[model samples]
Target chain A: MDTTQLLKGVLDVAVLAVIQEEDGYGYDIVRRLRAAGLKEVGDASVYGTLRRLYTAGALSTYVVPSDGGPHRKYYGINTEGRTMLAEQRASWTRFANTVSLLLTEQHQPTATIRTIGDKS
Target chain B: MSTTTSPTLAIHDFAAAVRAALSDLPSEDVEELTDGLEADLTEQAEDLDAQSFDPGDAVGYADELRAAAGLPVRGKPRLPSAWTANKLRTWASAQRSNLTRKARSTAIGSRTLDFFISLRPFWWVLRGWAVYKVIAALVIGNSIASTLPSSGTEWVLLLLFVTVSVQWGRGRWLPWSWLPPFRTLVSVCSIIALPLLLVLATAWSSSADQYVEDYVPQGLLLDGNQVSNVFAYDSDGQPLTGVQLFDQDGKPLTTVGDPNATPWVTTYAADGTEVILVPSSDVPGRTGWNVFPLNTVDSVDYYSQPSGEPDLSTTTPAVPPFTQVRPLTQQTPSPTAPPTPVPSSAPPVAPEPSATPTPNSGGDK
Candidate 1:
């Protein structure tokens, strides 16, 4: 029931999608995710997802040294990451539409409940 | 740039504590997990202020990072129902890592801590000694004596315990430091060892005190044996009465037994008459226990006085070894001072020569 629990399942796609638009470092990705209205996303979760994706060869990294602080490791989506992101986007659209249809049809509860129950 | 200086240092320390908390992981994995942690933490600190990033927050961030990466929890996993236990584990972990971070924040503090860490072997040996002494005192009933083992078995035990403790300290024993239960047990035992070691030290010091003090003789001694009561005879072999004796140094010779010991001694006369030796007091309030042939009392009168002091009125003088001893050459000390008159307050001594044979006047010798 916790949004964080739901966020954990889709955080990889979110981080990949954020990096797909532009290369970003750990905190940069977290900020972009938050600015995009996923305010409940954890800073460490984004960092961890970036690392995980980079290790999986779905992302590439480069170090950007700063004047006063440590060097930032920026992540950018790769071919494999973009292809995976496209697939997930299509799947999300289908899933979201299906759920939206079920929710908006108020008088079709018996039909919707029967459909979900049968799948289960 | 000027404002970012302090926050940068704090970010470094926070990242270091997070790394230390996850030290159980593989070095490569830890590096991967925390590769750019300082850069991230520094940016976060600049926006929120470094005060928001406490040690617990750093540890929680590390935990979340690991969980999201599908790694096992830092310590051995527990049942999900143990929520409070998990909180306590996180709290203790944060405190330990926080202490380490604070200590290493300064050069002098870090050096001092490293020096103490180098002396852990000495402490391990001392802890082993303390454990041995406690077991000897409680289980083997040995007095706290020496740091060095006294006997063959004790030496073996001491060596075994020291080896085990040192191995444990060196991480050769109980290598599963990542297990929280084992770590907690070790911490609790180390805490208990502090007080137990104090007790051993106190007992050891008191035993040393006993050794340094001179021996105090309890009472009269004859031939290295305790003399219960003294009896004296004159050169003419006649039994003496109301005799006051002293050692060569003029210390009054009292009974060898404890005055507070049980007050009755039963003796048998040659006629097989059962006689109980009772100590008699002379003056109204004081007992002349140094007087030879301590006065006696009848059983009835002796038992009637519950205070253990024999009634002077009903008391009689003790019988001697013989009614008449063979004569020895009689001699008298040349009068250096006039003979002193006997005190009138002295109890009366009735020398009734009963035909019943005498028993040893040294009661319960």
Candidate 2:
């Protein structure tokens, strides 16, 4: 399975989790996500996801003016977003655990292998 | 490397190119992108030797940096939303196709409509004889005032003409139901009262001229009294005794001396009837000649010298016999008839006059 497709399913939850750690700018958030081993995440795709999460009320934005360069827009998760992330994380963990158990279950073998001329 | 172009200039040029490429983006986004690109270029410039800088490589690097920064790619630009991208594409295509043509045609159509709307009523006014008459009266009045020597009156008449013309034009152009009550009143007054007032003023001025001709002294003359003619003589009559001239205000204008005084021929009939012959003198500040009977002189003539030709050619025409004055012995009947008797059922009081009367006063008393 493509991890990119899998990450697409969990991108909003991942973004919310990152912001839950600390509020960060778009580029900073992308760097943090890369540090966390999601290296295949495209910059444009993360930015798009960030913008969508913001518009969906899962994240809030504030401008921090910087003297050395352009002002940076920082995003952070709110209470409703935290609650949703927790619930999605819990459901994903439970489903993954159940699938793992089913895959790892041992099966008992039945009866015999036939030989060419069995016994007379 | 020998060129004087600054590194900042190159950076700014790059930024302008970026802006041009990203013209469809929002203003805030464009500003952010330009700022970020400039910072990146400055860093790149600081790291490399200025003399070894290549503009093509710099542009290609800038494009790569922009792509890394999550900006939309040039050829296959991405929008924030799919719906917005489609809309922008459609609008840009339409703009590229016929924007200037549509703008030019719209401008021409609007201007033509405005021109016709502005001019239609004035053309109608010119075409209609009655409307033209009122406008002509206003124009004549205004022109007369404007040509006069006084600047104050010229300004006043100019203001009046503009105001009346605008009001009248509005009334003529708009329907009655569309007009406010005050505007309707102004339109009516401009059409009717203003012209009538102008005619009356002119008539009053002429009447004043007649008064001056009858009463004012003209020159030293040897003939009949000037005062008696105030009631009867025509200023243009024959046997001119003295010439009377008047100003525009109808006041008798005096000359510097008796030399500049208007001269006339005088004659008398045998029965003490005097006839004055006043010739026309086109002197500056003088208007028309007048004759008057000698007795009607309200004031004495100070100069008493014979002026001009005393053509006493007994060419004096015969005077008609004067009617003798007689005191009345009996009361004369009133010129108006007695009031007719009202019927017993009718009221005794007379009927009131109508709203407006004929000049003969048949209806309105």
Top-DockQ structure, candidate number: 1
lDDT of 1 by residue, A1-120 (tens): 598998997888888888999998888998899899898999878877777777666799898998876688888898768866876788888988997897878655454356634754
- The lDDT of each candidate is 0.69, 0.50
Ten-residue region with minimum lDDT total, candidate 2 chain B: B293-302
Expressed as tens digits, the lDDT of each residue in B1-365 for candidate 2 is 22247877876776666567666556765554454445545544655586454344434543543454345656675555775655665555645433443333577866776686789566433323223334445564433211122456544554565545555556544456535444544555556654554565577678778898898464443243322122122222222334464558986533211333544333443334334533223333222233222211111131343543444322222221111112223354652542222112322222111112233322122
Q: Give candidate 2 misplaced runs (Cα > 4 Å).
A: A98-120, B1-365
**True-vs-predicted CA distance for residue B184, candidate 2, Å:** 56
lDDT of 2 at B23: 62
> Per-prediction DockQ, in order?
0.43, 0.04
| Backbone clash total, candidate 1 | 0
The reply for model 1, stretches above 4 Å from the true place, is A110-120, B1-6, B49-56, B77-365
lDDT of 1 by residue, B1-365 (tens): 13434666766677888888778778888898899887776677666656555324677888888887655688886465586667667667856765675687689989999998999899888777777877777787777655566789988988997887787777776656464476456546756875766676777878778877756666666666645455565656566877877779996566634544635454444455545554546533334556777665565445567776554456666755455553454253543432222222322233322223224332223
